[model samples]
Target: MPKLRLKESLAGLKKIKININFKKKEKQMPIPPPPPKPIPRGLKIIEKYPLYEPFSHVVIVQNPKTGEHQYILDELQLDPLERGVYDRILEILLAEIESPKEEILDPRKFFAESAKKIVDKYRISLGWLPDVSWYKILYHAERDLVGFGKIDPLMRDPNIEDISCDGVNKPVYVWHRNYESIETNLQFPADEILDNTVVKL
Candidate 1:
């Protein structure tokens, strides 16, 4: 009877050892979690201004996640005073350039002064106007014609095909999808003509 009891106890101990060994093997052969993914770099922002063109500006803000560069217009935050000053300068430029009354009574001074004031106050720098010139004024005038002209609300319309001026004696030509080409009897003198053509090209 004693020998049988001893044999039974030994059998139970052997079973316990086998179960512990199984658990140890399972722990040693653990399935590791997948390696973590790498983090991506952030987006890049770019702003560019076209030379010899007023208000022909571009602001590109890129998104790394979307892989797209968003072209932002009318995103510049300007104060009411700044907006008013800009509009007034534009009005003066338009009136002067369209009629071009006299060489001595040039509106370039007004444009330069107003633009300079805005730049100084707002600390805004134009890409083309690094060195202000009469040519820059002409460019701005044309831009205003395209952007704020009765035909187009200045930068508000993106469907304008072409804005062309042959000479002061000749008319300004605008190409439209519906009308094909329309001519307006707008004239400018030799100086204005040469200045506009040269700056635009």
Candidate 2:
């Protein structure tokens, strides 16, 4: 009877050892690393300026996750006649201002002062209440005088390596920081506009 009891005890011990080994094997199995995270493509507005009242604007945008700048061309939505009038007004302003007689010491201050004078002149001489705000006037005039006008913001973006346009009614292309090359929403509707933009560049 004692011998039978010993044999039964040995069988129970073997069962316990087998269970422990199984648990050890399960723990030793390798676990996979989590899948790589996806890159974000959404853009956010970093800054903005009103270009024309109720219609056009200039905005500085960036990819929120990547911190990459994206150039935007916000155009005025107007009838051909109204747009023509505005263009003529802009041309007149540019012509009257003339080029600086000497090397400007402080371009920003000079442009700001000049823009204010121009706006004041329009109000007093022409009895014109420019539809745009004073700030908008300053932005446009300064861009034309000291910067590249419509393409100034694009030129200022460090992330854009190159800019190109195929022709009229085609979207402008830009070599972006993260996106490589991509088509921008901005487009030139006419050959003259494209030529003008190229001249500014």
Please report the candidate that would top lDDT against the real structure: 2
Instruction: Report the lDDT tens digits of candidate 2 across residue range 1-201.
Output: 011000011111110000011111111112222222222247776665443323344455777676666546564333454444445556666666554656665655665666567656665443444444333444555555565444555554555577776666766667766556665666666555455445433
Give the TM-score comparing model 2 with the true structure, all chains together. Answer: 0.51
Q: Which portions of model 2 show Cα errors greater than 4 Å?
A: 1-91, 105-109, 125-132, 144-146
Which residue pairs come into collision in candidate 1? Answer: 147-154, 147-155, 148-154, 168-187, 168-188
What TM-score should be assigned to candidate 1? Answer: 0.25
lDDT of 1 by residue, 2-36 (tens): 11000011111110000011111111112222222
Model 1 residue 16 CA deviation in Å: 98
Compute each candidate's TM-score over C-alphas: 0.25, 0.51
RMSD of each: 37.9, 31.7
Q: How does residue 110 of candidate 1 score in lDDT?
A: 41
The models' CA-based lDDT, in order, is 0.34, 0.48
